[model samples]
Target: MLWIPIDRSLDIPLIRQVYQQIRERILNGDLQSEEKLPSTRELAFELKVSRNVILEAYDQLIAEGFLVTRRGSGTFVAKGTFLEKRVVPNHALNWRENKTDAANIIDFRSGLPALDLFPRKTWAKLSHAIWNDTSHSMFGYDLPEGRPELRQALARYLLKTRGVACHPEQIVITSGATQALTLVSRLLLSPNDTVIMEDPITNDIQTIFKTTGATIFPIPVDEYGIKTALLPENKKPKLIFITPSHQFPLGGTLPIQRRIQLIQYSRKTNCYLVEDDYDSEFRYEGPPVSSLQGLEPECVLYVGSFSKILSPALRIGYLVLPLQLIEESRRLKWFSDLHTPSVEQLILARFIDEGYLERHITRMKKVYKKRRDYLMHCIKTTFSNEVQVFGYSTGLHLIVEVTNFHFSKEKLKQIEQCGVKVYQVEEHTIEKDKHQNQLILGYGHLNQEEIKEGIARLHVALYK
Candidate 1:
């Protein structure tokens, strides 16, 4: 007789209990391969349960290849079903616990927008309207190139705002800018191919290209962006990654002279330039600079996302491809999740077409500029002549260069221990020890009070 226990107290179904125990026994090798079991009637009689419950459990086991029955014979365990359990480490649990403990830290992490200001009511209304009026075809598999409505809207908006010259067919909507970069990497790179990138670029971007097994050639940037004069003359790179409108971390708008030089270099080497226009929408100085793609559309691939302007939760980003790369890009995008969520794309299209996106940006720009100005004032007042600020004219974040301070790992941990978290510019540098005195401070997500308190905490951490 088989030994099976039952508990009527558990909220779990009796069938599930029976099924799990039998499955566990089989996998644990307690039940030998091809061993026969008591008939359903016999087991039901033994367990004092309904015959139908036993039958259902047996049926489930049979369906899962755990058990089989011969004609005119009893059921038997399937062969090769036993598996040795392996221990998994608790690192993930530990990480989650640590993350929970960081809730009180005043984090100055960059690349985040004012999430509290997201138009939730407007978005909800759009979502409801979309769900009500959407055609049946929209719920099914969509074109990998994304909805025509969204692409057309993007074309008009990008032309008017960023001076990017591209048709709707050339835009490929992606999950986010990260995916867009991945697609670009896959499209242009092969193992051992060379890529030229900014020295102090975002670490995530560097990691993405490195995953392609390509070597990244780092060109150092000054206050005016990449030293185009220092671009490698010996090697022909596959692609050149840059953030021209507002260079990340360092925040230099690539000067026109260097922009032309970069275009000339790409033309000479027949390499494409990947322009990441991340947070140019919130420029605090003059009007936003035109994208590098506008100068030479065929030689540049422009990547943009709504993460900085709206919310990263949207996960809506796009790549403006050259004419020659559109077909293959569409194929690659098709293979990558078979297009982004169709309903969200439709909603965003309506958002852009109705002028909601522009109005939101205009509103947020003022809010961010105020935060930026207040942060600058706080830093100057607190640090006096001890620190210098860089890249304050544009973007949601700026860099503060402290006189003779190196943000080593131990010092960073100490700062965090003081209820403050700040990012070091050295963490993003390709060549180490170059940007040790600099730190990136982001103000987009924090209100004025949080900003002031964060600056205060940072001051205590840095000086104390």
Candidate 2:
């Protein structure tokens, strides 16, 4: 039996202080279930406090249903209550990747930036300027939607960079695109609503849809991205989400022809299409792909993030909604964490105003272009005529198809034991046997030296 002591020297009431500690210990599993707690008299004696304080604390916990009195059973721990365990995170492994494990050997996980190459000097200056010059509003809950300057800056930047025609009034800031998805899911979806997502999309999207209770329907994607023809006609969806600019994992551009068709699909079905222009700013080849949002401003919800282009730590993301939904979206944003942090929003607004973001993104595009080409070259030279890779012309990743090899969880475990890590395309699928023979390789964050070394190690892993 363990008892917590409350110090009498503290200004905080002994009952409150004692209650908080015991509550946290139980919730965090430090106090095991069915473990008998100390009697109120014993706890008061050890702490040198009035027995009333200990009694009060225990009574509060019991009132809150965190503890239960079992009559003669001596207050046994409550069984099958909500507080004990929550949020079981997934740890599934995909075998088609077969890249070298990160702990032992380098791995090419997608959507990561070569953070070592980020511009720290410029950011330090911006951070200093924002703190020194910003008003008191910068310290408080600014606006749930976003800071006026940051929203306007992002509005202008999106137009200039990605051809997204948006106004500050229509842009609602989010913590990141993931949080954007979380809030958007709640804002847009009702129970049992259908959601259209890319086949073999990021696994996190699958988790998001599941959590939201949205019945996700996989839309087939090709080299040019989501096939508008493959969209389900019988099951009308509430929302359709896609990475049209640079398709995730597969790297297709969802060309203008398909973009127009997708918008038409949304119009016909009376649904909204959520376009995630996640990494379009970092395209290595051709002119930047035109965003689907630019096609039909009224029907498409545009989402953009700084994680890939600027830095993930910034955690700044924005959603451009059509004016019709702006009021509804704003009301929801007011309740969800109020708003994003003001310091970053202020600093970033200044950074965009000063053209620092433009210059940095321009420089990074060229650097990433070199790295992407080098990877393609190595694969072409090494594989010779053996493997076929798709969507390497843009974005942070490309898929390599293996017709000869079979990917299984047991094989993934074998590769893991060998100290290699890779993501199989199948890991992202809701429908099985889709993308079973494909591997999504991420080289966006790796430099030339790291890329060559990692690919070489991957070859050795599979062959050996």
Number of the top-ranking candidate, with lDDT as the measure: 1
Could you tell me which 10 consecutive residues in candidate 1 have the lowest summed lDDT? Answer: 92-101
Question: Could you tell me which 10 consecutive residues in candidate 2 have the lowest summed lDDT?
Answer: 75-84
Candidate 2: where is the Cα deviation over 4 Å? 1-102
TM-score on alpha carbons, each prediction: 0.93, 0.78
Prediction 2 TM-score vs. true: 0.78
Candidate 2 local lDDT, 1-464, one digit each (tens): 46566677899898999889888887777776776778887878888888998889889988887778877766544544335566655644433664544457566688888799888999899899878887876687678899999999988888987889888999999999988887678878987999999886888977886787789998878888888888888978999989888888788888778888888889899999998888888776677877778888998888888998878999999999999989888888888888899898888898899999989988988888888889888877766766788887777787877667766887756655555456788888767787777777888787787777666656665667
lDDT of 1 by residue, 1-464 (tens): 98789999999888888899999999999998989999999999999899898999999999999999998988999998999987778885565346425778888888899998999999899989999998888889999988999999999999999999999999999998999999999999999999999989999999999999999999999888999999989989999999988888899999999999999999999999999999998888888999999999999999999999899999999999999999999999998899899999999999999999999999999999999999999999988999999898888999999998889999988888888789999899999999999999998998888888888888898998
lDDT for 212 (candidate 1): 93
lDDT of 1: 0.92
